[model samples]
Target: MYEHSSTHPADPTTPADHPAAPDGNALTRQSPFRRTVLRRVLPAVAAAGIGVAGFAGFAHGSEGGRAAAATALSRDTAPGSALTARAASVRQAAAADFPTWGTRWVVHASADVNSPAVGLINKSAAGQDRITADYQVDTGHQVCEGSACSTFMAHLTGPVTGFLTVVAVDIPQDRLPGVPVHGGGQPQPGGSRQEMLDRAATWLTADNGSQVPYSQAKVWKDGYRQDCSGYASMALGLPTPGTNTVGLATDRSITRPVSLGELKPGDLLIDAAGDNNNRHVVIFEKWNNDAHSSYTAYEQRGGHGTDHRTLTYGLPGGDAEFKPYRPVKFGD
Candidate 1:
């Protein structure tokens, strides 16, 4: 449900098909449920072969010490020193997958989309003693159609056992509600990223026809939603032509498809929801490479007039991260 505050105006960017709260945790696998089938039980049976593993000691002993006079360095040695250390700690926590690895199950949104882990959790293992990694479905943004559009493909390595398959869940177009398409013409305020994102979020909330109501914004001549994408579209003066069974892109200005490798800050990000086809949309803000993988973003959560927060996810939400999907190029 959407929350309200007087400080923010009505937003227009919320996608029409924004998803509801996710059903459950992503650890448990949907298939492989049958007790009698042979191939269905293969994975659970094979996992029994792993032995009880135990972690050993760390070698912190100084091998060859040459005593010398020492001067301790101060914490102020660098600007933002403390802040950097805190950031490092946050990253370290996100990276560790030990406690919840084996007990978790993989919950696929559809045959196409797989879950991106929201957080790590622990569960007792029935098949093997080893901890299994927990994974969950992604529920922010709009893509091709709806259902399964947000499906995922994950990469797994040793000590972090998870998924390593390549199939996409397909959200069909029919179930999705269309975006109320409108194009703001030239001469209005343009190029403000946050403003645009706010609008998109508002519009999306409105589309769901849910119980909550969103905030409103007043441009020169129109009453806008205070969500993210709505603001982007309003700034660009793109028309609210009508909703598509699939979600709408930020700019009608886009002609050529953009490759994921070339995404820019202001470009629009789309997502597919299970059963609904193209359920939501959000904008890309920035990218950081120092992390293990790329993250896509969205501005609000819980639908309707909700407070704004930054939400990041696996690169492009699917296998598209591996190849390329014609992304809308900036200044194009």
Candidate 2:
């Protein structure tokens, strides 16, 4: 069902994925000075589980204060609790299951046992800790601290839980998966047309063709976002974590606009306006017919994972925002 004819079927209506909103109420009333002071002191107080009365005085009007109090209380009641134990276990498991693409750590955090972890940040060689990629931890859902939830695709083995575990591993430069490497392990600016299509095909049936799940908030194990732009980046052999649709469309170094008639295999059709949820991109495969009214394309959509289907985007009476662009790497 991955391939389709020129009479393209109606695309499935998928909900837009959006990042989580900040909890504005958490620090709304605290002055800068008070907030700074609280940040330095709350961790120690929470760990020691002391000064409940004193901390309660500060909790009067701030959600952050109340949340801190609750944390302290939880720690006090169960020093070295099951969640803590599970964190240690998950950390080891993540390390043992480290991916070959690069060396990074998964720092896991959770709200409670009933809910899945809210944060899973990866620390990369640049000394920056971020949620650059996502994998399914278990049958349950996994979410970043301030991002939306995505479905579980790959499963994590061992004693896994709804708690956070941080695992760190080192990846050598030469082994960056999926992207072509040259000049002592540096990823090439772009890939060949066949290379792009081959890379795109992997996700269609990931893990020997099982299909990587669709996720705006998570990255596939290959270290690319599991969204349209990210998938396209993998095919193009761009750097890890990929660029946004706007970046792909507007970045002259990456791609240049082309007329609809100029599109070739491995080129792109990107809708580069609006926010992440509104914008979309697809990799051009080939025209479905000699008439040039429809073409087959590969895309990692919200509801569906990787798909190769016929589309009329940018053709007459089709979606106008989706303009064609050729990857600079092709040099065609």
Candidate 3:
């Protein structure tokens, strides 16, 4: 299961507060200018050897060596092996592109283009190497270049059953987006409150503008568990596969307890004391009334995948286990 248990099961009925699901056709419709740009850019991306097959020899080796490597990559169909080979290829590409840079390059990946990058490859020796390698797979796409070349997007497949566009980028440790430029403060993960909400909104219509299904046992294409905590982690810019409900509640580096009256957009209401099947968390969006008796929140529940609805989980007459927590990423 996705580490969350909801009192409400997945239901077909849409709540009054739930935003209508997007129209699939309308979502796919692109402006002529966008289409023209894609046509011009895709060829360049392919020529740059950005795909899995291309990456096999993208950075190193002679023609024959490249062909052999590509063939070996093709033969190794296992997801874990493929991800390792791909990560190695990315590392090699980074090394070749920026040879003077040290081995301290950390690679962040996001399956969603709008979402913040999660730490896929850490600068420290103790990073998650092949974290979601065995999950699912999706084809690769070039999401950045030139001015925005800090990140590259690709795809993966697995148990979670969704296409993963692995957005991997080789960013220097000190140069990471949220890092303190003068090296005086702790590095914060990237994303403003609006950006975080925007990231959470992506999953609502992730599948061609449709809600990503819930899965406690699997992760969504974005590599987040399709559960309350996983969704919260994605919103907060935490590492992929996400921290558990307990971790979200207790980890000072990630979040700290706050009074209900202090709740703001992007804060969490977490019930972390119970087992996975009983634990849950929700993203507090805003109070429905100044009275603070009811508020709107984003949740990834058992039956309904991603939902934005009015909830009183932590209010006076609400579920007592739920507590307000301000994500530490927001800073004091």
Candidate 4:
């Protein structure tokens, strides 16, 4: 549903792990200095606009009943305008192709680190643009200052191995083992940010041995293999296809940007160097006594694996020079 966008300015001067924001509405600190929550609300509109249940054989049925020939999602189009409707159906199909929230997909890409799959998806969406001016390709979740489609896909590199599909917010019980379960099952109920965060914590089973595996599901038999954005994506249930450090915290539908001192326990630390390779993201564990003196975080690194490290402010190594953001639940 997205490429990449410059939602944040890149500041690669530092490369160190650091503490996270605290929990609750405004970042609460007991210090003498003033406290203020960075205030901004942006909702993540679905690029995954259509759902699978809506897909089917809707083409070639004549202008009377044909819907989308691509995915078969149901259409609301009235007859006598099938040509216009056919193009709209394709756009809907592209939207339906996305995975649900809290659900991850093992994307298969032909080029760059799993980026070809994204291009394929985007290309399909953009192809519909030939239908008319109203149609557009996979416009990423509204985080960029301009059109999400053109701006986000402008920068593309890497393979799809490390990718995790993020989708819209979902229920808490959906976080249970093998939830949003494939095939028919009783629909899982959703939860708030706390519930999703708690569920993500359960995946940190092999803290000592866990590595940031590209295909976490495949390699996860040994342990939960996760990358930084994958962990945050799961924790927030930001809807699939998922986003990278570049879009993680800034996705309008899921979170709002915040200053570092205003961070909460479930907030995120993102250092998006305007590029996915140079970018890194982490989840803030908590503030020690709300003093802002020291803190801990959960992250997936290259050699060390997924770790919960205690870090002080102003450390180096791509962890500093970052910004904090609050999940939607906390902000609402």
lDDT of 3: 0.45
TM-score for all models, in order of appearance: 0.30, 0.47, 0.52, 0.39
> lDDT score, residue 100, model 2?
13
Consecutive 10-residue window with the lowest summed lDDT within model 1:
73-82
Model 2: per-residue Cα lDDT over 243-290, one tens digit each: 777788888999999999898999998776555545777899999999
Q: How many pairs in model 3 have backbone atoms within 3 A of each other, for residues 3 or more apart or on separate chains, i.e. clashes?
A: 13
Give lDDT tens digits, candidate 4, residues 201-244.
44444223233333322223211124556556545544322355
Question: Which of 1 and 3 is the better model by lDDT?
Answer: 3
Worst 10 residues of 3 by lDDT: 67-76
Query: In terms of TM-score, how similar is model 1 to the real structure?
Result: 0.30
The reply for model 1, stretches above 4 Å from the true place, is: 1-16, 20-232, 240-256, 272-278, 292-296, 304-330
lDDT of 2 at 316: 81
Clashing pairs in 2: 103-171, 105-167, 106-166, 108-164, 108-165, 109-164, 134-219, 205-209, 205-210, 206-211
Candidate 3 wrongly placed segments (more than 4 Å): 1-190
> Which segments of candidate 4 are over 4 A away from where they belong?
1-190, 206-225, 313-320
Put down candidate 1 lDDT per residue, 261-291, tens digits, no spaces. Answer: 5665555544432233223344565565655
Best by TM-score: 3
Candidate 4 lDDT score at position 102: 16
- Reference-based lDDT, each prediction: 0.27, 0.45, 0.45, 0.34
For residue 204, model 4's alpha carbon misses the true position, in angstroms, by 1.7
